[model samples]
Structure formats: C-alpha cells, structure tokens
Target: MVVNTGLYAFNVTCAHRQITPTVNSIYGDATPPNTPADFEIKVASPSFTRRFFRPQVSFYCDQHSPFKPLPLAQAYALLEWGMNWCIATHDHTRLLVHAAVLVKNNQAIIFPAAPGSGKSTLTAYLAMSGWNLYSDEMAIIDLESGFVSPLYRPVCLKNNSIDLVKQWFPESVFTSTWKDTHKGDVAHLKASSWKQYIQCKPTEIVAVIFPKFVANSDLKIYSLDQLQAFETLSKNAFNYGVLGNLGFKMVDKIIKRAALFEIEFGELCDVQAFLSEDIIR
Candidate 1:
C-alpha cells in the first residue's frame, strides 16, 4: 500500500495484517493513486519461524533494516518511526531539525526539546487548539529561505501523556497504544486532518522555543542569546555535520530572524497563554 502523506509518499508492504486498521484510521482518503513514493518500506516477519513463534515485526526500508525486530503489536508504530528515520537519514535537500513545528497566523515556532520534556504533549495541545501542526517530529527548514514546511504525520504521545491528551481532547482520533516499547506506552494522535495539512505552506520561523516540563511549577521563560541558541540547535539537528557549511549558514540565518527562548512550565495552558499573548502577537 502506498501511504501518501502530502509531504512524502511511502510505499509500505505490511505482512502483519493487524497494522492495517491503525494506518487506515490515521490516514483516511489521503492516498493518491499512481503517485511515486519517496521511500519503499515494509513491516514483515524477520524470519520464517518467527512469524509462528514469538511473532516479531521488522521494519525494512528498501534493503536495509535500520531497527531491530519489535513485537507484532508495534508494527504500525515501527512503520511510523521507520518513515521518520528514512526522511532524516536520506533527505539532504532541506535542513531537518529534531523539533516539533507549530504555526499560527503564518508565524512558525520550532520546539527543539530532548526526550521527557513534554514536547509531544504540548504539540498535541497546540495542534488541537488551532495551530497548524507542520511536523510533530521534525522541522523541515528550507536552507535558502529559512522557512519551515509542514509534513503530514501524527503526534506521538507516550505513557502518561496519552491519557492526558485523551482527557483534554476526548473527540480526537488516536491509535491503540503499543505497550512496553522503547518508549513506553506509546500512542499516535491525529491532531489535524489531511485538509489542514494540504492547506499548510512553508512559513518563516518567528521563534525557537526549548520547552521543559516541570512538575507543579509556574511558567519560567528564559531568553537565549544567539550564540547559545545556535549551539543548542546545531546539536539538536539531525544532519548538521552532514550538511556542513550549508547547515551552518541556515542555522545562522534562522537565529538572526527568530526569537530564541527557553520555557519551563508545568501547565500547557500557561505556556500557550504566554506564547499567544507575548511571543506570537
């Protein structure tokens, strides 16, 4: 099956039949016929006997299997992760950052946070609240224009965040949680529809926010200097070293134009209020 996610087309062969419903639910009516896929991938049993024994699924991008075989239950999740890996590893035309891209009123902000920072949760909230979710996992920045483009993908929530998001937005569509993965209790939230994704265009980045979630704390916003922001962003980038001079120049340009800040907050609403009233205005 060819899953066309507006930004990239993935030709996926799923040997695990159970993974199909989750894929279909998340991406409905987005498939385009005869469209050449950007990556040819598959999620199948690692070995002949494994299919009948323990039942593990392996993600293969063409001839290479980037990840080890996971349990059959995580086939869809593995496929999603594999797709992200394919883009980050293969695509060099754009400067890709390991960040969540969210846009409002044509102003885009890239949240480049480490794991356990509640980045995904914040992204899910903003996306559901009305902000255009460009890409939940990556910021597709144009090297020349320094603008960020949207990718058709779901926001991945893990552990406690899964229930928190479900409680916040009960009507939102979510995939079945795959328990005991590398990232424990993981689920993917469909924050925006395909129509919203197609309407999104590359927009100039207005801010670079590094958010950290603190338990039961007031909003703390710290301004980051250009040098600090540049260094941190470079480290967070997937292909900074690979892109070399081009990547350096692109990061420099973005820092020059974008307001850089570190935000530590306990509540998503507080962060949203601060951004909407102060930064994005």
Candidate 2:
C-alpha cells in the first residue's frame, strides 16, 4: 500500500494485519492505494536462521533491512520507525530535522533535543492543550520558504510518558504500549481529528526551543545565541549533510528569524504558562 503523507508518499507491504490499525489511526480514515511509491517497504516475520526461541519481525526498505528484527509484538512500532527511517535516509527536498514542531496563534516552535530530553512529552502536552501539531518526530523545513510543513502523524511516547499522557488527556487515543523496544515502551498518540491532518500548510516558525525535562526543578529558561542554536540544530538535522550548501543557508535563515531558548521544567503548567505569557504572544 502507498501512504501519501501530503509532503511525501511511500509504498508499504505488511506481512500481517498487525500494522493495519496503526496506519489507519495515524493517517486517518483514507487508505493509500498500493500505487507506485517513492520508497517500498515490508514488515515480515524474520527467518529462523538464528534458531532463537523468541519470535521476531523485521522491516525492509527497498528489500534492505537496516536494524535487526524486533519482538513480534513491536511490529507496529517498527513500521513507524521504519517509515521515519525511509524519510530520513531518502527525503532530501526538505531540510529534515530530528525535532518536534508545534504551532499556536500563527506562530510555530521547533524543539530539537536528544533522546531523554522530554521533547515528545512536551509535544504531547502542547498539542493536546490546543497547539497545532505539525509533527512529533521530523520537522520538514521548506528550504525556499523557511516554513515547516505539517506531517500530522501521532506523537510517540515512551516509558512513563505513555501513562502520563493518558492520565492527563483521558480522551486522547493511543496505540497499545509496545514494551522493551530500543526506545523503551513505545506508543503513538493518534491525530485527534481530520481537520488537523488537512491543515497542511507550511507554518512560519517563531521560536526554537531546546526542552530538557529536569525532575523536581524550577522552570529554567536560558537564551541561545544564533551560533549556538545553529550548531545544535545542524547536529540534530537529518539531511543537512546531504543538502550541502543549501542546508547551511536554510539553517542560517532559520536562526536569524527565530528566537532561540533552552528551557528546563518539571511541570506542564509551568510550560503552559511560559509559552502563553511569553512565547505565544
């Protein structure tokens, strides 16, 4: 089946129906046909060559699998990760960054953080609290326009956050938790409405925030100079090296226009208050 994510499309073949509802929930009601795709992928049960007792499933992109097979129950999460890999490795038209993009009052903020930095948790909180969700993983930056497009997929949660978000937003829909993956307990918060998926225009970015989840800490906000922000963003970007000079120019432009900050917080209310009183306006 071909999945058209508005900006890019791919053809995927599944070994079983395990990934069906996940694809449906993430992409909305319309199913992509099995047409010609930008990239072809498959998720199937791994061969018993190792003769291990555990059942495993592996994802293949254009007949090539990058990582080893995972537990059978994590097929859906593997598919999502595989799709992200396909885009990161192949998609060069947009300046892909390992960042979560969210917008409010016509202004967007991009959060670039390493794993365990609370990026996705903050994204889930802001997205549920009325901010527009562009993406929870990759931020597709239009090189020419310097605007970020919406992927409108699910917000991935890991470990304790899966339950934390569930308790916070009882109405939010999420996939079954897949435990013991490389990301440690992975689940995706599905796009809440079709309107969100259809609101696909590239949004202007106003801030670049590096969020750090500091336990039992007061809200600490620090300014990031353009050079600091640029260096950090370049490290987090997926296609910067592939895009060459175009990538440099684009990142430079982005740094000039957006306010850069590093924030450390323990509570969601502190984040909400900060963004509302200071950032959003």
Candidate 3:
C-alpha cells in the first residue's frame, strides 16, 4: 500500500494486508493508485509476526520476543515519523524545524524544543482544548509566502503523557502504545481532522515559544530578542543550512514578523491560561 502525506507521497507494501488496521484505515487510500513519487516504504511482514532489521539500523523485533507488543495504531505513528525524517533530511532547501504548531484566530505559534521538553504534551493539551494543530513534530515554513503551512499528521505522545492526556480528555482519540521503544512508551494522537489536511492554509506566525517543563518551576514567560530567536530557530532547523542564503532570508522574515518568548512551566493548565491571556489576547 502507499500513502501521501500532503507534502510528499509514499508507497508502502506490507506482507500482510491486515498488519495494522489503523494504518490501513487512515493511509490505505494514500497508496499511489495513480501518481508517482520517489518516496516509498515496504513492510516485509506484520510487525507482530516478523523479526526484521535494516542495514545500520539498531532496532529489531520478533513475535516471540519479550519486547512489548506494538499495537496497530502505534505502527502508523512510527511510519509517519520515519517518513517525516526522510523528507526533512533529504529536502534541504526549506526551513524544517522540530516544533509543534497551533493556530488561533488565523495566527500560528511555534514551540521549538528538544526532546523531553514537554513541547508535545503542551501541544496536545492546547489542541484538545481549542487550538488548531498544524503539526506536532515539524513546523514547515514557506520561503516565498513567509507563512507556515499546516501538516495534519498524528501527534506523537510519549511515556507518562499517554495516560495523562487520556485522563485529561477521555474522549480524545489515541493510537495504541508501542512499548519498550527508544522513547519509552509511545503513542500518537490524531489531533487534526482530515478536512484540515485537504484544505491547508498558510498562516502568519505571531509568536515563537520555547517551552521547558521544570518540576516545581514557576510559570515564567521571558521575551526573546530577534537575534536570539533567529539563532535558536536556525539551530533547531532541519534544513536551514541546506537552504543557504535562501534559508537566511526565510529566517529573517519569520523573526521580523513574530514575537518570540521562552516559557518555563510545570503545569499545563498554567501554560494554557498564559497563552489564552497573553499570546492570544
């Protein structure tokens, strides 16, 4: 089967048609029944029944192994993530930052942080509340328009956050947990709808936030100057260096248009309240 992720299309062939029900349900239609793309994926067998590994790749799984079983839902999450990496790493002419994006009132806010920085957790919380989730792992900025385009893919939720979000919004949809992976227990939240994917819009970014989850830390929002924001954003970007001078122009436009900040918090509620009162207002 093949899938098109809006930005790029992929062709995936799995040994078993019933390997991942969730993946099939969401991406089954994406299989290139007509068009063509350079990106493609081929799954040898059902992850539950096969022992597999690729060259230079360290992870492998088998049916009888003690490793925790990865549910079908989680399989789709893994697939999407791998595809994103492929696109970002190979397409080096655009600015691709590891960030989560949420839009309000036609304005977008980007949160760029390293792993374990509570970026995804906060994104999930705000998305479930009211914000439009653009993406959870990537913020794709258009060089010409100076606007951020939405990538409506799954939101990767990790470890304790999986259960925390479940309790917070019991009605929210989540993929099955893929236990014992590199990032501990992992799952994916389908935060944005399919309609958003089809009707994507370019949004002007109004704010850039770098979030850090500190236990017992008071909720603090500090202003970030344009120079600092530019440096930080460039470092977090996946393709800034690849774009060369064009990348510099894109980054300059973003910083000039957006207000930047660094937020430190331990509670999602406090962060949400601040965003509602300060940023959105």
Best by lDDT: 1
* lDDT tens readout by residue for model 3, 1-281: 55666666666554434446767555444434355754656443334334443211111222222123344424554565566767677766457888999988888999999999999899999888888888888898887887887875778889999999989988867777778666888887777666656655788888899999998988988999999999999998898878989888888888898889999999999998888788884
Global lDDT of model 3: 0.75
Q: Residue 237 CA error for candidate 1 (Å)? A: 0.8
Residue-level lDDT of model 1, residues 51-77, one tens digit each, is 999899999999899999999988999
Using TM-score as the yardstick, the better of models 1 and 3 is 1
Q: Any runs in candidate 2 off by more than 4 Å, and if so which?
A: 31-36, 48-53
TM-scores for all candidates: the values are 0.98, 0.94, 0.84
lDDT of each: 0.93, 0.86, 0.75
- Tens-place lDDT per residue, model 2, 67-169, is 8988888998998888899889998998999999988888889999999999999999998988888889999999999999988468899999999999999
lDDT at 131, model 2: 85
Off by over 4 Å in 3: 16-18, 25-35, 45-77
**Rank by lDDT, descending?**
1, 2, 3
Clashes of each: 0, 0, 2
Q: Model 3 — which ten-residue stretch has the worst lDDT?
A: 55-64
Query: Could you tell which candidate, 2 or 3, scores higher by lDDT?
Result: 2
TM-score for candidate 1, residues paired by index: 0.98
